[model samples]
Target chain A: MKYLRLVLRSFLRSKRRTVLTILSITVSVALIAILQSILATLNAFANNPDASNRIVVRHKVSITNLLPTRYADWLRQQPEVESVMGLQWFQGVYIDRSNFFPNFASEAEFVNTVFKEEIVEYSDAQFREFLRDRNGALVGKNLADKYGWKLGDVVSLKSELFPITVRLTIRCIFRSKRPADELALHFNYKLLEEGVSYMKGRVGTFFVRVHRADDVPKLIERIDRHFHDAVEPTYSETENAFQLEFLKMMGNYSAIIQMITGAVLVAILIVTANTMAMAIRERTTEISVLRAIGFRTSQILAMLMGEGILLSVLGGAGGLAIAWLLAGAVRGYVGTFLPYLQNFHIDAGTMSLCFHATLAVGTLSTFIPAYRAARRPIVDGLRSL
Target chain B: MSGEPIIRLRGLAKSYYRESLEIPVLQGIDLEIPAGGYYALMGPSGSGKTTLLNLIAGIDRPTGGELEVCGHTLNGLDDDELAAWRSTYVGFIFQNYNLVPVLTAFENVELPLLLTPMSRRARREKVEEALAHVGLTEWMEHYPRQLSGGQEQRVAVARAIVGDPELLVADEPTGALDHKNAEEIMALMEGLNRDLGKTIVMVTHDPKAAHHARHQIHLEKGVLDRTIEVNR
Candidate 1:
């Protein structure tokens, strides 16, 4: 307690320097927290994708090479396959030059049934209405609001591959807080079949939702066997494996994430080491006095290390509080850019690592300076003017 | 220097090493300081009076000496034990009244007593008594920078006696004081010595300050020569 007053006085005496150091610590930690939060949310969303129980069957040559339309009928006959649906990448742009979102050509009859987890809203009546009209469409709430398209509003879209401008009547709009299907627009696939040029009797891919999540592997093998020698050879995969392949094409997201993590740690080390060095430099006389008053060299060392731990914990708590308040909102805002991320945590494990790194900087940074202080002769220290 | 000794040193030797050469300061000297006596040691700068005082105060280890204080030979005591001995037995008074700048006079005086097991109430009472003894009862809460030179020295005297140590050692106790303030500080020490029967050993280069002592010893080249003994 006696030594604590001395330490407090010393720190208080250099308020500006201490405040600056703390500010640096807080900023670095907060930035690190935000980065980790974004990465965490993306990892969670991608790893636990809503469509993992489903499989995608795209044309073996390219997505533009549609599978024979008869493949869906054949797949539905398989005992393990419950339902099959079609999806085509629409590759379209809105009437206005600035607005951008993904548009998908999908089967109105089997789309919601095969991708049930992605259904934000719909019923049998609306599904029949959309399938009956070649011009009918359902858009995401964000896309609908972006272009002010209400139900029955004619929306014009430019198709890069088709010669004619595509027009659609909005049949419904669905908004979801979940990222997976929240930003997509579903167009009538039957309408696309007549307007767009394609190989005859073909669809973009097959989506198969299994009866049991565990039977997916056996079901995949059975489904693949049926298409092994077909004219349009198929590439079938569970939804998660498809996502993994997409992420793999991204050149090493995991390594990039690790690099970000390491950069944050190194930034923290720089600030902490700077703060500790500054703290030790200013307390030479006070440290000497404490040693002379019968506190051992080890005790003096403890005194300094204690002060640093307190400072870091202060900065650490400040940073984590900022993260806790802002992470949820930030995740929601960045939903489209990286859809997998869900939450950020300053958990015990990260905190424990922070503590150890902080402790190392606090304790070890004191050695060269505190020891310079401790090694001075008492009479020499007392004689200082 | 004494008929009945409270501190004894036999064949004392101290050396300062410059590289490999041992530059001798004190070579083969014997001295004694008696209990309940006021003595002054006078010498020029570098005459080894401060070194001898430090040796006696157990603040510095002697290279070779059979140094016994209050009948315990200090030859074999470790640093912890030596510090314990100094806290319980030897009191120090610095020339500049080395009160810690951050502490009040009362708190500064309470420092040596912290080494003891005394409870707060007893310690407070002892500190009050010590302040009253030095005639600065009103200055207890003042910082050293706030007090006059004489008052700061008196606080130093109070701090020394607060531990109830048997030996009081002062190095150049009145060196920095003006004559009138120096006299007041000397008179305070004399009162503590003569009235309370506390053994006080003061080193000074000023004869007017030494005049307050009952005995005086002159140290030249680490050898003490007994001078005039006066009974006041």
Candidate 2:
């Protein structure tokens, strides 16, 4: 305990160097925390297709292929599949063409029943009126924000695949907690079909609400088996598995993150080692003094190592704090592409490893210098002064 | 008058070899120092007075002889053991007053006491007594930098005596001091030898400093001449 006091004094003696080293480590750990947090959050959010008992039933053929307009009605008639809704991508862009949002078509009547508590209603009357009006659409709050679309605003969209111009009056605005969902523009399929007659009776996907989550896998397999030899083969999977497949296409991103973290850790170790060695070298006489005063060689070693640990922990905490705060500013820069930015948390186990690693580096760098200082023939050390 | 000789050296020899040339620092010397006796060694440079002092202090090994201090053979002890023994049985006051620069006079004195199992209160009490013995009671809390040469040397003396060791070794203890502080330190050493019965062996070339000891020995070319006893 007393030896620790002497070690701690060295850190206090040079506050500037200590703080700088701390900032270095903080940056590394913070980057590590932020990267790992976003991936984990995204992975979890995308995988969670079932809030309770939900299943997405896309085309019996390719999801790229359109489903029959009659499927939603057939799905609603089934005892297993409770209440169905169709969601088709509209592929629309804002007037400025710079802002991006999700553009899709779904039944305005059953949207609340299929995905309740997701899209906030703009007004009960306006919402009902939009579902009844053939040329009406509901814009998400984020989309409305992008184009300044008021309740009575009219929006014209240029379709990509259909190659047609579609216009509709904004009847209501929907709000969503999920930022991804908030930036969407939704309209009824009837308006989409009537506007483009060549695409009549064709729907994009069916959202099947099941009573139990356990029934999803079987329902997906059953849905697949029903159209096994269709013109376009169908692929069905759980939401997480579906997202995981796409994440796999990211090709070793997690591995890359780990590599970056490894490099950062090594860099920190080197910095700490050099600083510790320099400090020990400068205090050669002090070590000798401790030895002369009846301290054993081991005590001197402990003192040097203790000093290293303090420097590292100080550096580590400082670096971690700075990294955390820096990540906050980065949120405004990274924007919605990296959500859960505030989820950055310091993991004690990792920090403990850093602490122990620092201690090891301290011990390693000081070994030669401390031993040299301690083992000096006492008369020589005394003779020096 | 009270006990056996606290230190005995028999044919103690130390040699340095520079790649095949054996240079003997101390040759075939036999000596005994009893408790309470004050002995001073005087010699020119290369006389091995410092080397001889180092051997007696257990800081170096005898190349050919047996050295026993307070009933323990020096040859049987390791460096760590010797340090432990030195803290308990021997106190050193170097010529330049080798008090740690970072420590105050009190902390310097408190250093040797750290090795002992004494509580802080006991250590403080003994440090106070040792400093008071050297007449630096008021200067205990002052750092070495703040103290004069004489005062620093006095603090070194207090440090040496703090553990109440069996023997004291002074290696030109006042070499760096002015006449006033040097004589003041010499007087303290004399009192320590005469009154407290500390068996001090001091190495010096100054006759005035050498005059304070009851026994004066001369060493030349690693050999000790016949001793001359001085009146205390």
Candidate 3:
């Protein structure tokens, strides 16, 4: 603390260079924070604790392959199964191709029961009204709020996968634990079946809710075994695993993000190291004078290291602030295309990582140069003047 | 000047090594300066006068022989120990003033005191007193760049005396100053020696500056040539 003023004065000696170094670190840290937050959001979906008791049943070939809707009946008959629902990705565009969201055709009777953790809240009367009306649709609160949709508003969607346009009336607006889940719209599967002839008894997936969390593994094994000899073999996994499968389709995104973050860190380290090296080199004479005046080599090293760390921490803080302010806009933009990132925000873990990363950069970058400056022969330094 | 000498050197030697070759700067020179004595080392360029001063100040160690300054055997102490000893017993003033450009005059003067266990208020009072002694009290807040060459050297003098070290070693303290500034600096050193009884050793090429000292030691080819008791 006694040397803080000296360090601060030396740091501000070159205002332009210091500010530039800080800005470089700030921009790099912000990029790392945003990228890491994206990875965190995806990981959260694949590790959700709420998905423990639920299982998903899909065709053995691929998720794109449809299964017989009668699979839900067999799933429901199992002693471990509490409820089941058939869900299909509609791949529909509302108004035009620009407005995109996950719209699904689902069996309304067991949706709230099978996905109780996701469908956190909804009106019972509104759900009954949705069941009574053939063209009724259930919109998530975020989706409804985004489009300024209300009860009785008619929404028309043209399907890209099938030759049909289904006009739906908004009946129930439900809330979910995750903002990503709340950016979807669901309607009765019967509507799609009535619109297209071949889609009558097929669904993309069947969601099964087990009576207990421990029953999920056994039930998944039994269901896959029961359909092994049938015309369409089944693959069953817990809901968390199903979400991870979707993420897996993106191909090792975690490694890619980590690589990019690493590259950015290395680049910033080089930049910061170069700046500190130059600063120390410029003060060689001053350093020697201090040494000659009875200041210890360790004291000189401490003051220089303090300056470097202070610069990096300042940049790290600025970057975190930038990431925080832009989080909402990032969520809104990315939610349009990637459903998993709709709730994307910089969590405490990511902030801590960035802060620690900057400290490491500061220490590693300044160590060699500061040590060299401190250990240089005092006579050589004095002679340089 | 009674009692034992403040500085004792017995055949002190220093050399520079360039890879496989050796270049000797000081060789088998012995000298001593009594306590409270104002002495000047006068020689031509590269005569090893500054090297001798540096050795006496404990900033550099001799490659051979014994060196004792301020009653401490400098030859036996390591680099860190030498630094600590210098802080307690020796102060330095360089040819270029060597004030840290980033620090104000006050900060530069306070640099030596920061290494001590002195309180902030005590250090401040000492620094102010030193600067006032140098007639630079009003320029305390100004940076080195803001001060004149003479004023900067005065600040350097303040810094050298602020810690109240027993010995002051100056290597051409007026080498960068004009005639008027050099005279002012010489007068200040003379006053420090006569009034406060500081043991002063200065290396200089200026005859007028050397005349300010009570004794003059001349060096040639890295060895002491003669000693003269000044009539001043």
Best by lDDT: 3
A309, model 2: CA deviation in Å? Answer: 0.8
Task: Write model 1 residue lDDT over A1-385, tens digit each, in one string.
Answer: 6457555655555678777766766666667666655555445555655676788888778766878888888788877777888877776778553455667778777777786776657655666767777888877676666467778888777876555567888886765655545567788777777776662467778888878878888878777787888888888888777667766666777678668767876776667667667666555554544443444556666666677766666676677677667666664555434444423444555455555655555555545666666555545555563
* Model 1 CA deviation exceeding 4 Å by range: A1-3, A49-195, A199-282, A325-329, A332-356, A371-377, A383-385, B1-30, B34-59, B66-232
Give the best candidate by TM-score. Answer: 3
Per-residue lDDT tens digits for candidate 2, residues A158-231, read: 76656666788899788876654565677887877877776687776777777777887887787678657765
The TM-scores, chain A only, for the candidates as listed are: 0.82, 0.78, 0.98
Q: lDDT order of candidates, best first?
A: 3, 2, 1
lDDT of 3 by residue, A264-339 (tens): 9999999999999999998899999899989999999999999999999999999999999888889888777888
TM-score to native of every candidate shown: 0.76, 0.76, 0.98
How big is the positional error of residue A40 in model 1, measured in Å on the Cα after superposition? 2.6
Which one wins on DockQ? 3
Cα lDDT, all candidates: 0.72, 0.73, 0.92
lDDT of 1 by residue, B1-232 (tens): 3437988889887777899998777766687778888888788877777777777777666788688887778888875676667777877777877776667888878877765678889889999999988888898999888999889888888888998888888878898899899988888888878777778888899888889998887778877655568666
Decoy 2 TM-score against native:
0.76
Error of 2 at A240 (Å): 2.7
